[model samples]
Target: MEKNDFLCPHCRGHLRPNNKIILSARTPDNKVGLILLSPELGEYSVVKHDSFKIKEGEHIDIFCPVCHADLGTYHENKNLAKIIMIDEKGIESDIVFSEIAGQKSTCKIHGDQIEDFGEDASIYTNLWGATPKY
Candidate 1:
């Protein structure tokens, strides 16, 4: 199995995943926070927070404590997460999750689709270009 590691866009600090998918973070309020990215093709990110002042089912901003970079926003209501990923060569891309119409996710570069995955939709692996619509 190919290993995928998420890194901080600012410091390149490896955002190591725990037990295959859970990524830990420190909330802006200085409390431990968490997000879990499922291994499924169209997996969604599950976020759990306590200290942050977020209403239930609202999007919460997650930041990297090391560099204070905006990692992404997570919302448990829709089971959605949006993250900006930077590749090893300094290339950047967008990753988003949507649970509507079945769980779906996509990785895009400059509006061009890179990887598209869906639960009740066509699943494409090793993709590059062409965004997938849920």
Candidate 2:
């Protein structure tokens, strides 16, 4: 895997394909959809079917398309989903990001270092109790 390849934390399956992260998503009302997320961190652009409508503050349940694993970190942070990121050098890190629609928050945690991105990132930094390093 390269620097931006995302993986399912539970099954270690590749989540990104051809520069996009493919995930199975469900709305609160049980509306199912396929979401295409940008692989680049901090890019909030999404591509989904018009039938699957999500509100700004709506909480989405993201899953791994390959293993069907629920990616939400319910025990740790309910608003976020966890994934594994394998960098170009083959180092893996835990990547957590907001699952809330319209909320842009992403973090990369490797050992004791934390790197945060997006405006809403601060909403969960305190949950880890560690300051984000540049």
Candidate 3:
């Protein structure tokens, strides 16, 4: 994401790049919230306990209203833990490794299937740029 791409909706000022955005879902109520930190502006925007439903392994597209910039992407993790961006596509591209920490197993994104594990996994394709704009 570029530095001048985003602008604050309320102030119409440049939205700085902190390079990260976090999503969290509270327990019991299961309300989703967003926390955006901008290093350039040295400020943080917290949207608490909103009604947004998201699932694990899914991609989220964030945008700015003032400048209409594709801010970034986010991924929802397991449980009610604060969601983190596991993989960033355009701005930064790098291979990510995950370790089970002492567990002996090799998991791949698209690889051979050891067991049937029917209906547990499926592949999704976005034809004609049906993917999210961000």
Candidate 4:
């Protein structure tokens, strides 16, 4: 197991299995598939069956594979999905990332502190009440 583990905010079910964060996803057309995301934050590499075709810039809905809860609804922004991250020490944090295909943005929030990652992270910085950079 990695030092950090991803989980469903609703069910608190372990999402990281086999070194990958497995999520249930649905395309706009109502196609469902299992999406395997890298456990490392900011790593955009994705693994899924070829039949689950997703176009860049398209919107995808993410869910907890264990409980079937809509992860995206947990966040105020519909464009993002939220998950729970627990470190080896048992400290928990909120991990938010874009649900838009090909969009590179992720944020780790622990208490009042927010750590942004990826080039597109700045786009949602203000959503968390963080001062936007010029």
TM-scores for candidates 1 onward, in order = 0.46, 0.94, 0.24, 0.94
Q: Cα RMSD for candidate 1?
A: 7.5
Q: What's the TM for model 2? A: 0.94
Lowest summed-lDDT stretch of 10 residues in model 1?
A: 120-129
Clashing pairs in 1: none
Q: Model 3, clash count?
A: 0
Model 2 over residues 1-116: C-alpha lDDT tens digits? 44567889888888887778899999999999999988788888999998889999999999889999899954466888988888888888988989899999999899989999
Native-vs-model 1 lDDT?
0.48
Estimate the lDDT of model 3. 0.27
Residue pairs in clash, model 2: none
Local distance difference test, candidate 2: 0.88
Clashing pairs in 3: none
* Cα error, candidate 2, residue 19 (Å): 1.3
The regions of model 2 sitting more than 4 angstroms off are 1-3
What's the C-alpha lDDT at position 126 in model 4?
91
Please state the error at residue 87 of candidate 2 in Å.
1.2
When superposed on Cα atoms, how far off is each prediction in RMSD?
A: 7.5, 1.6, 13.5, 2.2
Off by over 4 Å in 3: 1-13, 16-35, 38-48, 72-134
Worst 10 residues of 4 by lDDT: 125-134
